[model samples]
Target: MDFSTMIGHDTIKNQIVNSIKGNRFSHALIVTGENGIGKSLIAKEIAIRLLGKAEEKQYVDIVEFKMSKDKKSIGIDEIKSIIQETTKKPYEGDRKVIILYKADGMTEAAQNAFLKTIEEPPRGIFIILLCEKLENILDTIKSRCQVYKLNRLSEEEMLKFLNNKFESLSEDELKAVSAFSDGIPGRAERFLEDKSLMEIRDTVIDILKGICEGKLDKTLLYTEFLLKYRGEWQEVLTYFLSYIRDTLIYKETGNKELIINIDKINEIKDIAEMFSFNKLNGIINIIKDTRSKLERNVNATLVFDSMLVKIQEV
Candidate 1:
């Protein structure tokens, strides 16, 4: 998609345009930002602009490599394959571009193997690495590229885009989705297309209330039931954390505006009374920690079940 269709990141788009206009486009470029902040989207645009060819005609020269779906890391073999293919001339475009998503997930061997290629990149070759954190990438690699970070969209910008795109939502609904999107347009779009996200969010809120009411058996039972959905554990964890966060925030500040589960403020405030401030913080930390562990290829069921049991401590 083009910049006009993108929700925000106006400054990033300007920088890209200016860099190309000034003939300062780097052979190695890194676009780093949090998920759903449009780093990959911008990278694709940069590739297309630099190619100076139509997307359909030059599709052969645009290689997209990513971490394996079932694996945590990109292996050295994959990088070697890229190196072999990139050594050849472009099929149609002026340049051969490799869009490497999740490049930070590359193993040490792969990263070391990649250094030589990027250090002295071949003429008419562009490598773009999209990442969530700069620290995860090698310093030598970072030094070889022009790095640009995309900033989170303001709540106002996210809300404005949501309001303009979706005609059905009321002001409250718009505010709710925008806040729940957490400064990300792609997330807001997901919420708009799938109403069930809100439905599942409410169900998790109910489960949190069940826990607060000392119905531990019932709450864990619900968690087990929800865990049957193979890929939705993250979604469950997200809303659960949102509920716990809202409880802690509201408990500490007595502020409705800070809560993210906008549809059930009263229920959240009621649950807020069940925990001491320290206990609330403990639970929040546990959930956050579990999330981080899950990203490192940890067992989902164990992490989630342990999280449920640990919340009982508070």
Candidate 2:
């Protein structure tokens, strides 16, 4: 993809394009951001452009490695191979581009090996490292590389982009997609892939309903659900928090635009009426704290139970 195709991060894109135009491209660069924020796409586009190609599909000498692979824990051997690959001349292009996805997952030895290469990189080769977290990288490696941090797209910008891309979609549908994606373009695209996202969303709402109605025992079952889908719990929590916030907004302002859970607006309205504003605020805080604990590797089951009990009491 070209620069125009990239969504959001306008300033970063301009900087990258200007660097390439001025022939001042850095030897090693780190593109860091959350998943679905287009870090890889932006990195690839910049690499392709640097290699004198308008598109990635036309690049023959470029090598790409996605770090999500089981064998993707970039080790010394992989770094050695990368070094070997970049040392060679480009097959058909002016530059050999190595696009490393999730470079933060690199092992210590691998990072050291990479550091040696970065200290004296190949003249006509470019390396772009993509990572979700910059903290995992070695200080030496980070210092040598230029870093581009991508921010989350704003709500209005994301909504406009989605609407223009999906013109046939209704306003409410677009809003739901935009809100659910949380300004992440790749995740907004996922809604198109998994059309059942609405259903998954409803499943979460049902779980919330069970707790609020006191139908399901919140002791162990909640924790079991969390453990079963550890990766998705964060998303579930975000949706829950957004739904509650929308409900509260609807209650106070009576505005539908502020409500994200449009499909269950009635249920949300009931929930808003059931819980006072202070209670809702407390629950949101509890969920946020629970999320932080989960990130710190706390026992998921225990966290869920404790959070559920606190929320239930309110």
| Per-model TM-score on C-alpha atoms | 0.84, 0.91
Off by over 4 Å in 1: 53-58, 194-196, 225-235, 245-260, 269-282, 285-302
Q: Please report the TM-score between candidate 1 and the true structure.
A: 0.84
Q: Compared to the true structure, candidate 2 yields what TM-score?
A: 0.91
Instruction: Give the C-alpha miss distance for residue 190 in model 2, angstroms.
Output: 2.0
Which residue pairs show backbone clashes in model 2? none
Candidate 2 error regions (>4 Å): 216-223
Residues 131-241, candidate 2, lDDT per residue (tens digit)? Answer: 988999999999999999999999987987787688888878888888888889888887767645554577667666666676547434666656666767767687778
How well is each residue in 227-294 modelled by candidate 1, as lDDT tens digits?
Answer: 66426567667777778778888888998877666679888877888878888788878878888877
Candidate 2: how large is its RMSD? 2.2
In model 2, what is the error at residue 277, expressed in angstroms?
A: 2.1
